[model samples]
Target: MRSPADPARLATLLEHRAHRLRRDASAQAEQAAQRDREAQTLRSAADKRLQAAQLGEEHGLDRQRLFERLRGVAIARAHVLECELRAGHLQEQAGDAREQEQQLRHAAAGNHSRARRLQAVGAHIDQKHRQARLRRQERQIQEEYTCR
Candidate 1:
């Protein structure tokens, strides 16, 4: 029931939305990557501190110093865990954005396909109208000749 141009307009709107989603997805992915890098850095630092704490423990270091090193290791490990959690959350957000982009793209493709079909139908209708006009003109010319 839609006009030939309707689908085209709808397609344009859908394509714009798809483009926006893709841009958002790209931004989200970049943020996720940065978060992941930070998480890795935190994890590396935590691992080194933990390893040092373990070595110190084996050496039976002074009780106070040992407890302080252990506490430092614990704090570093907690920071690493927190960073990892944030990275995971950011990755999930990126994934969601990408999924939305894909959905928008699919909708845009469907609208474009519909627009093409509508245009084809409109062309056929115009051709039929032109043919009918030519037939009427021929009939009028034949009648005039016969009457003359």
Candidate 2:
């Protein structure tokens, strides 16, 4: 029959899983940042469009030209709103990923602590066995001397 996996090995696996989770979380954060940048760009574009429309109105643009500028401004604002929504969604996803990563790291730390405890226990048992063996050997030598 196959032997069960040792605690040290299990701890190593847990560490690896934690590392992977952290990497995934970092990627998620990067994606969220990218989305934020895109949203900001869209917002800037909308602001510029609104400013141009305002300027045109102040300069006494004809009614038809003013209407067209207003329409463009409206469309730009809508795109900005959509981009902002997507950015917000990405930020939420990133936060969730970070939370998951933290949970996994905690679990991994617990596993590592258990593994260390098990290792200490194993070492203690080995030390006792060694001491017992030495005592037996010393007793045998004494008996041999007495018999001689």
Candidate 3:
């Protein structure tokens, strides 16, 4: 049988693992948030460009080339905005997945610790039973010798 200290060591190791997982998960979340903020800024810039383009297109009917240029600018901005949003969404998904993995790891540690505790309790009970039986046998021997 392993020493009582084994479980404590295992628990400490598991705790360290859990802490690392949590730290990594938090870092991923922070990175995702940064990406989201960046995407929002890009989206805002695209919206402004689109608004400016629309205004310029509506202001002058004679400037056909200017209107075309504005339309092109709006389209380019829209594409860039989509790309930024996609990056943010992908990063968010990655972060969420990492967090979920961390949660699973934490649950696994809890389960393992609980199972170990139960096993230790069972072993303790068995030891107590054996000692009780030995005591009973000694008492029976004494009683029999005295009766004789």
Point to the candidate with the largest lDDT.
Answer: 3
Alpha-carbon shift of residue 93 in model 1 (angstroms): 1.1
**If the candidates were sorted by their lDDT against the true structure, best first, what order would they fall in?**
3, 2, 1
Which sections of candidate 1 miss by over 4 Å?
1-60, 144-148
Question: Over the stretch 39-116, how does candidate 2's per-residue lDDT look in tens digits?
Answer: 567667756765665534267678998788778778767766776676667667656756665675666567566666
* Residue-pair clashes, model 1: 0
* Candidate 1 lDDT over residue span 1-148, tens digit each: 4465554455566556656655665665566567566656766775676565553425657889778877877776776677667666766665675566566556656655665675566667777779999999999999999999
Considering summed lDDT, which 10 consecutive residues are worst modelled in model 2? 1-10
- Candidate ranking under TM-score, highest first, comes to 2, 1, 3
lDDT (0-100) at residue 132 of candidate 1? 95
Q: Cα deviation in Å at residue 120, candidate 2?
A: 1.7
Question: On residues 31-143, what C-alpha lDDT tens digit does candidate 3 reach at each position?
Answer: 66776676677676766766665544254456787767767887867776786777668667766766776675676567566657755776776688799999999999999
Q: How does residue 134 of candidate 3 score in lDDT? A: 99
lDDT of 2: 0.66
- What is the Å distance of residue 101 in model 3 from its true position? 6.2
The TM-score obtained by model 2 is 0.69
**Model 3 lDDT at residue 51:** 64
